[model samples]
Target: MLLDAKFTIGQRFKHIRIEKGVSQAQLVDGICSIAVVSQIECDRKYPSAELWGKLADKLGVPLRELIGMQEKQMEVSFQIDMVRVYIDKADHTHALELIDELEQRADLLEHQRIELLICRAECYRTARVFEKVVELLVPFLQNQQIRQNVEDVVLCDTYNKLGNAHYWLNDFEKAYFVFNSLDPDDVHFKISNCRCWNTLGNRG
Candidate 1:
């Protein structure tokens, strides 16, 4: 998840940089010191509010778009192996109970709720209730706080799942729409893109 967040922020910064068509040094001029911009893009440090505002102004984006609030919500990083063990060995009832307990005590930071939502969506997906996944995820996509917190991969996965669910219901139009919402250049888009194309072919 940390990797996903890092990549998302990096991609956003790169997108803004390209949109502005300015060199790193040029972007730093009169905005932030050159070293600071370098550090921010490299994910070594977050930019200050003043620097964030300047970047947003230069890049023609909303100031909120440049802020990453998800980092604050990550209180503890659970071991992936432990999670896998629980998923693999525990019964559904027990798993649900554990998840419910975790959710209740999560106490997530500003944007951290998105992570929780994603986790919940996955759980719903595993239960083969795709409707529940959609129910949980669609709101997050539309929410400003959650949207800002989501990484590109998470966004891709959410859209892919939504498309998949619609496809299963033979709602081809909705599936196609969801798949088209993804940016082709994003790493997570490939599988959904293929599925969309395949569905189109079948329909034709």
Candidate 2:
């Protein structure tokens, strides 16, 4: 769930730094001035991507999690986490119940929309409600704005879910088409191609 990264990044960094007993001077490490780090910690400024990555590494968390606090601008972190836990438990019914409300908040941020869609799609996948996953993902995948703007990992995840749904529905051609559209260089494409071909081979 890649997110905007500007949200709560500073606060999270500060907290993690303190928890890890890392000093302000240690965190500075020449990536930026200590004052700049202070500004970032206070949410007074946003760090450059490279600087933030260094900061997250020093703090011992993934840059993705920094924004994934984006679940972007996760005003509803706890609510979303509950939905995630339910989905992971394969309780789609319960997850969907919570998801309906989450969808409304998604309208507020691009990352939220992507995150909620991912969560919904995964819940459907885990529940074997493949149709719902397809239904939930297709428009987002096709929306030029959404498609172009979505994070690389999020786009990959969207296509992965859609491809899996189509495969399960025995729509192998659609599955292949979707998976084939992934970048040849992407590792996921190779993995899915194997599964896609196996599915077709078994049918043949």
Best by lDDT: 2
Listed per candidate, the RMSD to the true structure in angstroms reads 15.3, 9.1
lDDT over C-alpha atoms for residue 19 of model 2:
76
- Give the least accurate 10-residue stretch of model 2, judged by summed lDDT: 66-75
Candidate 1 wrongly placed segments (more than 4 Å):
1-76, 79-85, 88-91, 110-112, 144-147, 202-204
TM-score of every candidate: 0.52, 0.57
lDDT of 1 by residue, 1-204 (tens): 112455555566765686668788888778778787777777787654345556767776654344443422333333112223234432234344445545566454544445556656666666677888778766766783444766677678777777887777677877777777777876666654577887787667
Q: Pick the candidate with the highest TM-score.
A: 2
Worst-scoring 10-residue span by lDDT in model 1? 76-85
User: Candidate 2 has which clashing residue pairs, if any?
Assistant: 67-70
Candidate 2 accuracy as lDDT: 0.71
Q: Over the stretch 133-162, how does candidate 2's per-residue lDDT look in tens digits?
A: 898788878894444977677678778889
TM-score of model 2 vs. true structure: 0.57
